[model samples]
Target: MAFVGREQELAELAEALQRAAEGEMGRVVLAGSAGIGISSLLDELESRLADVPGIIVARGHATEPRSALPYAVLAEALGDALASLTDEPFKAVVGSAAHDLAALLPAISPRLDALGIGREAPALEAAEQIGSRVAESLRGTLE
Candidate 1:
């Protein structure tokens, strides 16, 4: 069944995608209290994007226990996309960003090795800092 009462939200997402198509970068974050229909909204959003070429939708889940794990949600969501990077021309572009990702997602170490990049050492310090390298690497991967 179709969801109603979110035309405004859907329009905003559509506009963001249109800007992205025009080479403009936009970020959208949806947050709300639990059981407020966020998933329904995203399901509708994903359905709407299905007809658009060059669109990839990756969603991460954060359970109460898993939520505390750094980058765990990202690892889950991007597991397939990360695996795809081991092959093709993307291998050349990945370079050291492999280190950045491997720091957060250890399961990709084998994939990184396949790319000849080797495993990234644990990225956290005694203080457990991640900084911006992961974000940059994520952008590189998405681009």
Candidate 2:
């Protein structure tokens, strides 16, 4: 309801939610300065999607000037995915590497550390590779 000027963002979010309902993992990365209305857009989309099936919404906030750590934002998003997918005991694999996965993706590393994943392993390049592998795995599950 806080969205007053985000028609484009709303459309994109609705599209992603539709994809998710069709058994796909839809990801949207919204980046902008503080107080830009990202949260408002997300809220509006959820309201519009109230009856949509199989689409789960998870949110995390990354403070400005803290986007350097690898996979910080991604980790939060993935954590949401894993948690939702883990209703079945057999789906524990979805979250098996969560801890280590946080180490990958340097762009969000500083943010990840702030979220309590302050590990130094896997390094940056290696972390990226690992993150890609995990993304592929997640896609496989959604497929």
Candidate 3:
């Protein structure tokens, strides 16, 4: 589909991608009423960045059915990307925090073990601690 207008939004996305390539964190948020081309803008961005090196893109949506799941949107978006990481790089990026993340994101568990991160079960009583660790690990991975 031809993406019409939104030149300014596309330019901002391009600039954010450039900064991210330069080792800086970049973020873009789209907000609008339904059917206003937010998804179209994202689709356009994805197409434009399809061949960009050293960047990973994942997409997810939240709906009423999955709203009860903690970090459901985040997990859906990042699970595959995180799972694709090889043992060495995964360990380098996630380090000791993999254990906690594994609890939250089971898709990454195999990679965690491949990195020699122990597979100890997180105690049920430690939900808060585990959540904090997972968030920190995710931040480190994105940086």
lDDT of each: 0.70, 0.57, 0.71
- Tens-digit per-residue lDDT, 1-143, candidate 3: 67889999999888888887788885565766778888888888878877876566666565445756777777777776676566666677666666656766887776666557886655656657866766776777667
- The candidates, ranked best first by TM-score, are 3, 1, 2
TM-score, cand. 3: 0.75
Say which candidate scores most in TM-score: 3
Q: Which ten residues in a row have the lowest lDDT in candidate 2?
A: 89-98
Clashing pairs in 1: none
Worst 10 residues of 1 by lDDT: 120-129
C-alpha RMSD between model 1 and the true structure: 3.7
Cα-lDDT of candidate 3: 0.71
- Candidate 1 error regions (>4 Å): 62-68, 72-75, 80-86, 89-93, 115-130
CA lDDT of 22 in candidate 1? 94
What is model 2's C-alpha RMSD?
Answer: 7.4
Q: Which candidate achieves the best lDDT against the true structure?
A: 3
By summed lDDT, the worst window of 10 consecutive residues in model 3 runs over 58-67
